[model samples]
Target: MRDRPEAAPGAAPAGVAGKKSGNWKDLRARVLSAAVLVPCVALCVWAGGLLYGALIVLAMAGMAMEWARLFGFGLETRRGQLCLAWAACVGGTALAGHWGGALLVMVAAVVLGPALWAGQVAIGCAGLSLLWLRYMSEPGAGVVLFLVACVALSDTGAYMTGRVFGGPKLAPRISPAKTWSGSIGGMCCAVLGGMLIAVMLPGALPGAVWRGALFGGLVAIAAQIGDLGESALKRACNVKDSGTILPGHGGLLDRFDGLLVAAPMAALLSLGAAGGIAFWYVGLH
Candidate 1:
């Protein structure tokens, strides 16, 4: 067994201090990235239609590339094949309304990706599913925007509350930084912000604000779960961050990990009456 060297009398622990210092840099980078990303996301949402679709597809493609790189497939021919399949899955679903193609890709990934590229497969499928959430749902774009906003608010709440309170860890093994205080704070923010947005809608649905609050709270829950899932993946893969693609966020996957799982689940909850798309806007007057 190797020995852990003792710290000097007045000096900080060997690696701990460095980690603490790096955190500030990471947080600052996150803020800088958010400053640019938030406006762009809002604009695309407002624009709607092809603009939003194209942007999301591009992101998915980028994520696919990054996933392959993460799996050490960057230099292999499989990387191109996987990336192409991923783009087809996302773009097909977005442009041509094709779920079968995406499904096929998932099946192929499972069969061929058991040993390697499983994460890539999951990323591609999840990315496409989210795109489908935006593309296929009736009044989908609005719901997508709401989900994104709630998740964003939840993240902000978690960060602020966790830092301020510094209480018990929520899932110490999965994510050391998470805490119970952060969870509660995130949920509260989600509910309150969702209600506010619900009230501001053009035609407010009956109990729309309350229901929206619930939706937001649920979103926070899902986002946290996704965050944990990603953390676990990182732990298993023995890496930090997916990539350096995003200035502060690390990679597209790192930034949007929460949305990967949350979007699809939310879509299911908001399913429409006609067996297609979510009627999430139904109650909105």
Candidate 2:
């Protein structure tokens, strides 16, 4: 028999070292991706015309591809083609101000592929809501920015808090990394962001801290729910992520899951309010 090898003089076990290092293994890639994409997204949102529309189209296409993959469909497959077609119609109709046609298309797709088309419809409606908020709402860019900022803050806060204060899982079966601490931390961060936006953009938002906080809380809840929903879907599909288009982020759908549901909710609230996008703080006119 061969002699056993001696341990290193002062070395920790490989598993221990690995656990420590792996805690933030993906941070660098996540930061780098955000650094590159955030500025581009902000610029496009600020310049809400062809540039923004193009960004939306590109995102929808990426999301559609990911959705198809989640369902075990290749781009050349009939289901994949239908998914892409739905994506195209949604983007085209949203940009062309024909949202009614988009709704009809969504219904048709749902009927054609009931199992796969539900999420596609949600994503399509989100795109439509974003377009409506940008081109049709009173606050336009400011409202979109506010929505983006709150969701971003929530996501960031949840990630940071979950890593630092590991505890009971929020939904271990769906996403083991998520925790109750992270969820609360995210909601708090979102509230702060909302209040800050209200202060900075008094013309676009109401001046009441309570209203800002309320709006932030609601958006955070919606965003978190969206995140959980996507996680469940990924779990059901037996996948770790929706796709791999964005390094560390997995895919466009993974990154924008929160925004997907939140946008439509925000738009619906705005539509029913007297002040449109600024209705969070503004009273009935």
Candidate 3:
């Protein structure tokens, strides 16, 4: 043991050097991916028609492919499975006007995949909900955007809080880095974001304070669940990410995994008594 050669006297330890190099690579990839994706998403959302729909359909297809890949489905199996999943997602949006029917379709989508019924269902429903919100009119559009913002803020809060506090792990087996501190911080941020949205959207958002508070907190919880669920799946599969399409982000699935469940659940709760699928927004009032 004493005869074993040591690293150079001034050199960084191998583990430390590898970690630093990996972190820098991650940071660079994240920045690059965000730079391209953020603007494109913003523009498509702003356009709010065929442009957005097309992009969403493409994304759905990409995510479906990724999910299939995770399960080690062969090429033929994935081709058929992804095609069906993609169609189900887009087609179900047409039924969002009838919430029951749309939900039924999403339920059915749970059966149409290579493996992991849970993920298939969530992804399918996400596509349907995105289209529904887009076509639900101005208020729906705003709510969708607001939801995205809240999720983003929640993620930011979690990241900052977890890093600073570094307390008990949230799910050490699946996601070693997350902490209870981070989860609470994310919920707090979501609550604040919800209140702000209510003030700005008024009639379009839940009118009551309690409603807004509940909505935001619930959405944050859902987002966290979605994130953890993906992490668990990745761990089980022994993969770093669902795909490699998004550079630093890993895959489209990785980027939107949180939204896959959160968005639809939020929309479900926001349904108005008047049978409006979309919550009321500023212009509508």
Candidate 4:
């Protein structure tokens, strides 16, 4: 019989050994990541009404804290301010009960609050306010759900496409992982997801199917841009991960960066197309 090729140093002993080792590592990491993600997803998915709102509020608060931390702000002082400001903005939306103007005001507060404060406190507050407005003005829970689905699906598609196709990099400096093939795949997935949601929730959202598709495509592009923006920030700070909050996800900011930008834009488009009557009554009133 022919002699088998000699194994290299540090290599697995046999064919099965190498495969088994790789599988085990992957399984372990996935299991650990799932342990944290499953419960959080369930909580957001199953929870509804006030409970759901509360959970979302809490998440926004957590995200605000993370954002401040990323920007070099202290937790103890900035955290509380951020949480309070977010609560106030969300509360304002709740009080408005769907008022477009009120929702706009809240969004404006989020963007301007940071600049106004000109310090850690202001930045934290502004972050929270912006998040609150995002939830308030979107096409209700349905639109919010759709935006989340599209953003996530796009990201997933992009990763898979990039890995499998291995084309030219989209932006080598900002994000090495991004590829042109991946970007196209991601946008296609996003548009499909948007169309699916629009079909499912007819009365919940206004505008034609084509509009929805167009919006989805735009949001997909915007989300990708937002992701790159966050990556740039992390790189500038010379940090590996935003935080150790999530096992595989990294941090709240890491996961929500796309959502942060997409949510507000989706909301604005919905209001503009739908005429804000519903939002005015539900969000502002």
Error of 4 at 75 (Å): 2.6
Candidate 1: worst 10 consecutive residues by lDDT?
Answer: 1-10
Q: What lDDT would each prediction earn against the true structure?
A: 0.66, 0.77, 0.65, 0.55
Candidate 3 is scored at a TM of 0.76
lDDT of 3 at 36: 87
Can you write out model 4's per-residue Cα lDDT over 141-248, one digit (the tens) per residue? 555566677777677667557555756877656555467888888888889887777667646444546655776787787678767776766666566556667655
lDDT of 2 at 176: 64
Model 4, total clashes? 15
Sort order, lDDT high to low: 2, 1, 3, 4
Q: Give the C-alpha miss distance for residue 282 in model 4, angstroms.
A: 18
- Across residues 1-285, which tens digit of lDDT does each residue of candidate 3 receive? 000111222344457456334433455566687788878887887787777777776777677777777777634784547554655554445543565665565566545543655555667678777777767644656667767767766776776576556578787666765789889888888888877775676354446455556667877888888888877777777776777788866777777877887877766655542445334222233
**lDDT for predicted candidate 2 compared with the true structure:** 0.77
What TM-score would candidate 4 get against the native?
0.66
Better of 1 and 2 by TM-score: 2
Best by lDDT: 2
Error of 1 at 27 (Å): 3.1
Instruction: Pick the TM-score winner.
Output: 2
Q: Deviation in angstroms for 130 in model 4? A: 9.1
Please provide, for model 1 over 1-285, each residue's C-alpha lDDT reduced to its tens digit, 9 standing for 90 to 100.
000111122343347676445434556667888899999998887676788777777877776766666566673676556664665564656466666766665556554466344654556556665666666654566667788888888877877676566578786666666778888888898889888876666555577777778778888888888877876766556666777877866778777877777776776665642444343443333
Candidate with the larger TM-score of 2 and 3? 2
Q: Put the candidates in TM-score order, highest first.
A: 2, 1, 3, 4
* Ten-residue stretch with the least lDDT total in model 3: 1-10
